[model samples]
Target: MAKKLSSAQLQELAIEKKIKRRNFISFSAFFIGAGAAFGGWKWLYNSPQETAGITAGTRQPLRRALNKTELFFRRIFSNDHVVKTYPKERAAKVVRVNSDIGMSTDNFNAANWQLSVVKKNGHVLKIGIEEIRALPKTEIVYDFKCVEGWDQIQHWAGLRFVDFMAHYGLQEQAEMEYVGMETPDGAYYVGLDMESALHPQTLLAYEMNDQPIAEVHGAPLRLIIPVKYGIKNLKRIGTINFSNQRPRDYWAEQGYDYYSGL
Candidate 1:
């Protein structure tokens, strides 16, 4: 004897089958997507790595990706590109200071602070703060952007980096590929490409918000560069070196973007 199902029973059985089919397809798709992501990560992990002198390797693929990103931004970047400026009234009332790396009393003495510049030809020049102030002054009221995603309007006054280079007769060094700036103790350092280093708004700033720059905010001498995030504006510059090869960057060595353009 065979049993026959009613229309109601047949419809219920069809719905159940469709539900199971849909679930299977959904699970299959989820697993496939997960596997693809894991496979990509694994491939990158197994890629070849090259050794740099002090650092062993950061993996070639990741380094290449960072370099490509830098190149992409640089294609559209230029000194002539003007950064937005604000009225001095909008500047932050209280100076905000961060990263006191080389600003400690043990490392810095404003009395003995003389800029040390090393030329490509191995010549060294010691520059005093007074000499820097004597150069034509430029002031800018602009937003100070930080990598941590906070920004404040800042008022800064100092000499244009280009004029400083010209005043020092550093024409040869200015033409070099890179510039390196370090704190007195060499605790913190940043490398700059020539184009950005010579940006018209880049300044060796000594004043902020209509007053002398405070000790907490790199007093007497610091770089006020509008185009870069605060990190590129090396505080309490101790030494400047010129080279054809890319100079070392503190943040870049730790996997931050070397170019770090806006």
Candidate 2:
């Protein structure tokens, strides 16, 4: 005959059984979740490819998903959703230099830099740096985010894009669907929706950390938009054009999202 167990022994055995059952369920759940993830990844890997914004290719399903995400961000975006600014003390002392595709010119001259702005009337204005500086100056110290999983608090000063439009008599541009900007040599470019482009925090920045922008850091003029990842904060802006069609983006052509909003 089996030995009778005391009350304490019976309770201990019950607890042991309960723990084993719980562990088994937990392990089962983990495997199920992992299997689902693997299936999704495998499906994405085998998906059909399609043309990216420019010429690079991307999975059709992934591209559609990215577009949907872009639309969602666009729907919820508003001028009131401004990025918060911090005190200058919170900004980094040594700003990071990530890409130099546009600023790699050996003979690039900051003083002679001219901004080519395409007006709605089909006229191109070759604007000097002084013209940009003459506009009212606004400064912001905000978290400068990057897509590479890093960020820095930066102090930037420039002419607000909205104010820039009013100054240039280009208020009509705010009504456009998109704004496209590129480096002088056309090595780098980015596109922004009209709302993000005309946001109060967007700027045609000429200074960084209370000084003239470093040449490697986009120099005489660049763009400062806090609401976007660093990829959209174009450097060394050479040409700015208003467009009804979505502009071709350098990164987007490389399989990154066309609308790389924060």
The number of the candidate with the highest TM-score is 2
Q: Cα deviation in Å at residue 59, candidate 1?
A: 3.9
TM-score, predicted candidate 1 vs. hidden true structure: 0.82
Clashes of each: 0, 0
Please provide, for model 1 over 1-262, each residue's C-alpha lDDT reduced to its tens digit, 9 standing for 90 to 100. Answer: 8789999999999999999999999999999999998998899889887456322257778888878887787677776797999888998898687789877678567988899999888889999998988888999999899998989898999989999999999999998988999888788888887888899999999998878888888877898778888878888888999988778888777666677766
Worst 10 residues of 2 by lDDT: 49-58
Residues 1-262 of candidate 2 have per-residue lDDT tens digits of 9999999999999999999999999999999999999999999999988754452568989988988999999999999998989999999989998888787676777778899999888899898999889889999999998889899889999999999888888878778999999999988999889999888999999999899998889988999999889999999999999989888788888888888777
Candidate 2 wrong stretches, greater than 4 Å: none
lDDT of each: 0.85, 0.89
Error of 2 at 191 (Å): 0.5
lDDT leader: 2
